[model samples]
Target: MGAARSRILLDNDTGIDDALALAYLAACEHVEIVAVTSSPGNVDAEAVAANNRALLALCGQPAVPVLIGARQPLRVALVTTPETHGPQGVGYATLPAPPGPGEESLDAIDFWIEAARAEPGELIALFTAPLTNFALALRREPRLPWLLGKVVIMGGAFYHQGNTTPTAEWNTHVDPHAAAEVFAAYSAAAEAGLDTEKLPILCSLDTTERFEMRPELLTDLAAAAHCTAPEIVSEADPSGTRSGASNPLVRYLSDALRFYFEFHRDYDQGYIAHVHDFFAAGIAAGTMEHRTRAATVAVETESPLLIGTTVADFRGLWGKAANAHVVSWNDPDAGFAELVDRLGALARQLDPMG
Candidate 1:
């Protein structure tokens, strides 16, 4: 018998990496993306909604609903990453406008609550951006932690340098208050008898940085794209001068990576880019193996210098029970191999041969 497919609700900011993560999820055969909720982070809420719609259409899943969420952080001024993800949040990837407007009946928080209530213990909530929507949802439905089947988040940093500040990652740093609220609410939910085994799972910078998108992976993906969808490659090539060097997916990723790779190269002293959210999606879809450590994690929201820092209590310093599972380690070689395999699968799914 085939493995069971997981129902996932993806919350994203729809930047370059988020777009790649969306492609990964859409291509994954064992994942049923129940809904997509967008919030302001890498870009504004409107851009995120547009990106979600366009990416879904490009991936042949235009039927999926795209709901707009929070326009700003819960308790701070809006911070955006135009330098990294380009002004439109998707770099040079030109996508068509959404066919229709967003769902009018329910907003992002409402959509999350309704979906979770409908599915009970069968919905996986995947967050790849700031936690504003999640914090708001938890506030409206305090029992959400108990209702969700699982929660996979791509944020935080442990034993690694921060991407936004000296002490914090971008997603958490953008909305430390929301991150704090989320962690605290999950802890409270556990105290109220929620299952401990299904506590929030975190794929932090500590683990994701290990799996970088090197040139070889890009070459392999481009080759796969050519084999599965030569028409897409032709369209992407446009001038027909590149000799079928790229496909739609490869072109989109390459265009985005032009900026992303430069950012890492100049700032982090690396030529490769890491799709951090892809790891979170993989964890949610059960496509990758990882090693985790049970730790009591608390987001720092008070200190100006340390705000959004993930304070992991590896030692029993506060006498608090572990509230989250931190993915501290993973084999990069194997993980990237699986990722390439999945990307190839997605290419075929998006554009099947005649």
Candidate 2:
């Protein structure tokens, strides 16, 4: 893991998976979380920012700034999936409110634009939310692609079934217009001959869905953390049940993921959770293996039926240059194992008595 050196500027909706991603990043030693920005997706921007602050504090990174961005998606009524991620977007887990003054007043767009410019090519932008904030920032700073070191996005289902609509991913569907704007801006940068290495790594649902989390991972993590009692999360557990693990981190994760498992099972997808954002965060931190193909990616915004559907042309079928390196391969089992090793170690470090 290159967490000792990765400088990450994260933007997320702070849902269940987003919380897990943020917690993982915080656990890594010396990982410079430049800042975290809230965006609207699984929940509203306010709740998202709150979640970020709370998660950071729980992970012992309380000083990390949590900025509030756009409260609504660009050009659409905000649609939140409370049923999917619970009321506050963190499943049934109850996190304490942040303790101190945070980045509530600071504009997330301006903060990112300034950060990217002040430290040109030094910050990695990990966007795991709707593209509304990034799109709005692009309107102010059109050269975002040139300023940031690299980008990793967790949205869009290129070749897989959509979790929101029949043809649309949840993040993209929340704001199709913004997703289109982001891809178009990246395409422009690619046309201007930006380094292919710096091209955005799109961690679309096609690969992320493969990162399905199962109950055994909780057991492994608990064992690694040397918990006193066995930790179990099963499909047979009653709905709305919470974790009573001795370790705080283990308890938080177990309770959070229990809701996700139920969500998937309710949709007939079994008791596993598709932790999409965790893979993106891991890729940005250089802690996970992944493969991507250069593609000219675009979003369908105007069509009523296919809106928010991300279309990728890999064979130069479209005359445009490649804007994103769409992730094509990843190992879910390996990723889960790494999560247990890294996060479980961090948990033990945080609570030695456990």
Candidate 3:
């Protein structure tokens, strides 16, 4: 076998987009998923853990460990997006039940602590959920920032229209206290003269929204996967329609994304999906092209009306060092094309006879 290009520790709440992100990562041959820790957002932590394991198994990467993490937000009662991500977070896709909790089960915080300490500066961390689990990990080991090689986060609105609230994004709004703690930890590290190069690359909604998933991409993906029949997701279809795709992977993705498409249509965004996490996943794999701007980032945790709002000081107006490299822009056309090619390669591999 070939050497791994990047080692990643994925922390996500496996909503529809999160499932797509995990599938994209699992499909990539050069990427090594060290572990996955469930965080509450799209669903409860236990359900998120199940989604991660089920998707990984579907993608033929069942060996990757799936750990359980914080079930609720740090300072608030948990809120899940069943309306947006369906009841169990995978939309209409019904995956094989994950094996019962046993040796496969592990604590997220403990894994983060042990893995980082064991191989300092080797693991690249990616957070596509609320920061609850990572913040708890930081509380246990304050030096996690220095121990990890790099970090990539997918949260916050960053001046974009909010998907959850008037001023907040879904992930941050789910657990603003944990989000606050994460940025504060980085700010403290910068003040202490630590190597700030390890500051996370944040994929806020500003640019992520540009990577929309229209129904045509699914048709293209099906063609790439060499499916015997066309896979189509239509907005006019009766609600809760399921895919009858010939390819297993295509069928799974089609079912999941159909729910996402309907959700977006209901919100008046047409039948397109803002696959925010998938873009972040591409950045983590070093495959998708993108640009960034250094900024001092912070999330609001106090104001009742502004809780979970993220503000970025782009010009050092905060008189503090930059805490993150916020993504400024991304090539959505290239992004969509890359996604189709990569995911199609995996689907074709999984069911070659098609």
Q: Which residues of candidate 1, in runs, are more than 4 Å off?
A: 1-3, 227-246
lDDT of 2 by residue, 135-217 (tens): 99999999899999989999898789888889889889999999899999988888898888888899988999999899889
lDDT, candidate 1, 137-173, per-residue tens: 9999988887899899999998988888987999999
Least accurate 10 contiguous residues by lDDT in model 1: 231-240
- Of candidate 3, the 10-residue stretch with the lowest lDDT total is 97-106
Candidate number of the best TM-score: 2
By the TM-score metric, which is better: model 1 or model 2? 2
Q: Estimate each model's TM-score.
A: 0.92, 0.98, 0.97
Residue pairs clashing, model 3? none
Residue-pair clashes per candidate: 0, 0, 0
As a whole number from 0 to 100, the lDDT of residue 261 in candidate 1 is 64
Q: Candidate 3 residues 52-171, lDDT tens each?
A: 888888899888889887778888999898899999998999888767662235788999999999999999999999999999999999999999998999999877988899999999
TM-score of 3: 0.97
What TM-score does candidate 1 get on C-alpha atoms? 0.92
